[model samples]
Target chain A: MLENIISELEKQFQLEAVDHNSSDLVFLTIDRDHAVMAIDLLKWKFGYKHFVLLTAVDFLEEGKFQLTYILNNPDTKTDIGVRVRIDREDANMVSAHHLWPTVATYQRELKEMFGIDFPGSPRLNDPFILEGWEGTPPYRRDFDTKAFAASFYHQREGRTTNDPATYMKEKLYPNE
Target chain B: MSKKEFFPMDGDRTKYPEIKSDGTADIDLSSHKYIKLWHGPNHPGITGNMAVELTLCGDEVVEGITHVGYLHRGFEKLMERRKYIQNFPLVCRIAVPEPDYNEYNYATCIENLTGIDVPEKGMWLRTLTLEMARLQGFLMWIGGMAGAIGFGTVGQWANYCRDLVLDRFEELTGGRIYHIYILPGGVRNDIPEGFKDRMEKNLREIEGFMKDIRRAFFDNYVFKKRSVGVGYIDPAWVFDYGIVGPNARAAGFKHDIRKNYPYAKYAELDFEITTAKDSDIYTRAFLRFEELLKDIDLIRQILDKMPEKGDHISKVSNMMNLKIPAGETYVRSECTRGEYGYYLVADGSEYPRRVNVRGPSYTHGVALLEKMLVNVNIADVAQLMVSLHTYPPEIER
Candidate 1:
């Protein structure tokens, strides 16, 4: 059933990769430019109408961010995850809010958290979780959370870590 | 079937900031015709710490900007650093009213990524707890829904009824609010002795209270007047906005995750999906009430079908350092409010590469609420919000 979608899609655009995770779920990779068009095809032509989610994963070592758009078909009960890779340094992509209005919210979060830019998405500049966050997008791998916390807050004195086995042996069964 | 033919909405799009082709109205603050009002972060009408900035023209709201992040704990970023097993305790904090959905989805995602087998008894126990969570979640929502419209008596009765279900949870999982019971490979423990009988007793008492609530809340003229046609969720918005659970069900959509994408013991259990065609505040509230009763029957079915004695947990070799392969999968369950999902990405490391917590409220509360709030009377904002059954933590998380 999913093979038909892959074949049909391959005719119009170049297929980067196709993964059949399960009977009802399939993940397909395509170039960033054709990503939105492929998703549009899946929605109108294939009936994958329900917009599940749009999330980005930062691969700092490779200097790339993989954006995954998961769309579900309520009628056929199948899911298609379209994966697109974009450069992390100057991250930008086509806005899909035209397809799903709620995609603007996802795009907003992506813009605020990963420094990704969706030019035409509404409220793309407004903060999602943080109102005026100025530092590097916190979700990026290069952004060290421990360093951020250590620099911003103070550690309380006399706080210590103890291995449960060693601490239990020293306190409960001292002679054992 | 257009609802306009049956019951005309309370008000059509009022004259105010003109709506654009994209279904959004720009709030022009400079105009003296409109006044801005902040509807919470502290108000009881809202489920969690969140506020709506309502742009009002007299008593009608022209535009509502949803403001979240007041309660942002940043669990997603925190999960990126924590080990696989370490995040078990933290996932349940995502949704306070019903936390088991988070635990179940997170655990199931981990199991799927690592290819771990959960015992049958464990699956049954997980189902029992999830249904119990749904029952309690709906009970709490009823309290909020009734209280939103000044029906305080029903709220009190609903809370008391909810305490009965929490008592059952206390006995089974050893905690009232956060059970942390459903683990990755299976469950934390076996069912307690006489737990079924105790739960059955509570279910009967709850059923009795539900009947009383139906009379006091649903049948009342004030509730009907305030909610009957107050907020109508267009059936077309079901797929557009990713609406799920009772919200979509109330819109006459038979799209229940447990039925469409069966998981746990739901495939073995028999139940009907609750649905209605009205798609208004009253219809959604009443649909949820009916679903609350169905949950009681499902609890009974689980108790009857469960095995007598068996393994409830599978042992993982290492507790502290469990490394998962590079894979990504999305696991979801039919939660009380809607379809709660966990999208996990593991990069062959002890720490999860990325974890996206998908709460049904992410759509219903923020974007949909903002859209629905336009042109609605200020007085009905709370009632309309409660009808949507949104939890703010899910949005900010």
Candidate 2:
């Protein structure tokens, strides 16, 4: 089933390097323009009806936002993650709302959380899952939550800031 | 059958104007008859920390919009920053009523990414914890549904019965609400001695209450009248909106993750995928009641069949230095609400690159709620919302 999806994606989307390294997960990097088309094919032709999830992973080092659309075929019980990397400067992609209406909410959430834009979706600009008065998209790696919290909310008088990883390293592996 | 024939509207077929191609209804909400009302954030009818904005024409809701984020803690972001082990305790709080599913999903995702194999006893223990969580979640749903419709006594009864399950949980996991038992390698510890007997006794006691539950809630004429046709989800929309668990089963769509994609020793269990034909509030409630019975049986099977003496957790080299190789996986479990999936991306570092939690309520609470609320009576709004079984924290997360 996964091989069939990979070949079909290659044939239709044309000239794409796909990553199938993960078990039970297929990652296809498609052009930002063909994201909706790829998803439509997966839905109508490939029997991937379940739009499981849509999320963005920010790779600050790569200077791109990798938008992943997780689709599931109930018959095969296979999950396919379609990833499209868009320029961080121009973080925009065609919305998958036309293929699945639920994507509107997911896209709206992505827009609010990652500062991504889905121009064609309904309520694309609506405040979704987040209220007004935002500084940066909090989900992005560049947005330091600790600094933001310290500035916006109250903190203990003498409490020192500590990274969770560093704190765990010191507490758990002191001898090492 | 054609769309028009199957979905027969009351208006004249020929003379009735066609719906606009853009899918917008030509209705004016600014008229004097239309009144806007907010149904929650604090409303008892609402399930959790969320609200629905309803545009009502007299008693019928013309349009409804779900408003969330009252409980948004940015769990995904928090998980990304925290070490893998630190996330176990935090994920449980994502879903208040049923925290074990989140814990299970988180652990399973990490295990899948890290290629950590749990022992046989661990798998059985994990399954037991998941089922126990489902029982308590179903009990909470019963209470919420009954309370929503003003059936206070059943709510109290179900909550009391649920406390028995929690007592067992506290005895085993050291916490009643947030067990934090299911870890990445396996469970936190083995079931305490005499735990099986105590759990069986509790299950038998709850089973004894089943008759009264059926009589008071399921068979009550008022409940039947209020819920029979109050929130009917068309079977056609089941897959379109990605409804699962009891809601989809109640709609006659036999899609259970436990049966279809078994995880955590579910393949060894012998149970039927219970379903109902009617996709209404009543059927949804009845389906949950039926599932509670099945869950009791499942717990009994796990307790009886589990290995008597074995290691509950596989030994990890070190907690602080543990780093999963770079990989991505979507691990899901048959949560009480539905298919709760955790999409994990590891970056070969201490912290996860990204963690996206696909809670079932994200679809049920927001998209499906907004779509189903149109033309529904204002009185049945909360009833229908509770029937969908949405937890707002899951949605906001």
* Candidate 2: tens digits of C-alpha lDDT, residues A1-176: 79977887788786355767555677778888887798898899988998899999998999999888899888988878888889988899887787777889988888989999988899888786877847788888999888898998987789688999989999999998
Clashing residue pairs in candidate 2 are none
- Candidate 2: tens digits of C-alpha lDDT, residues B1-397: 5544332221242322223678754445555667789998899999888999888767777778899989988898988878999998789889998899989988888888788889999999999989999998898889999999998998998998899999999998999999889887899988899999999899988998878989998999999977876677888887678787898999898889999988999999999999998788899999999999999999999999999999999988887667999878788888878899888888899999999989999999988999888767789888999999999888878
lDDT of each: 0.90, 0.86
Model 1 spans with C-alpha error above 4 angstroms: A154-176, B1-15, B19-27
Q: Where does candidate 2 stray beyond 4 Å?
A: A21-23, A154-176, B1-22, B25-30
State the displacement of the C-alpha of residue A130, model 2, in Å, after optimal TM-score superposition.
1.8
| Model 1 agreement with the true structure over A10-126: per-residue lDDT tens digits | 999998988777788888889999999999999999999999999999888899999999999888888888999999988999999989989999999999989999998999999
Q: Model 1 over residues B1-397: C-alpha lDDT tens digits?
A: 4657444534566466777787767567797888989999899888778999988988888889899999888899889989988998889999999999999999998898788999999999999999999999999999999899888889999999899999988888899999999988899988988998988888888998988999899999989988887788999998888889888998999988988898999999899888998899999999999989989999999999999888999988895899998888988899888889888989998999999998999999988998888778899999999999999899988
Error of 1 at A141 (Å): 1.7
Candidate 2 docking band? acceptable
Worst 10 residues of 2 chain B by lDDT: B9-18
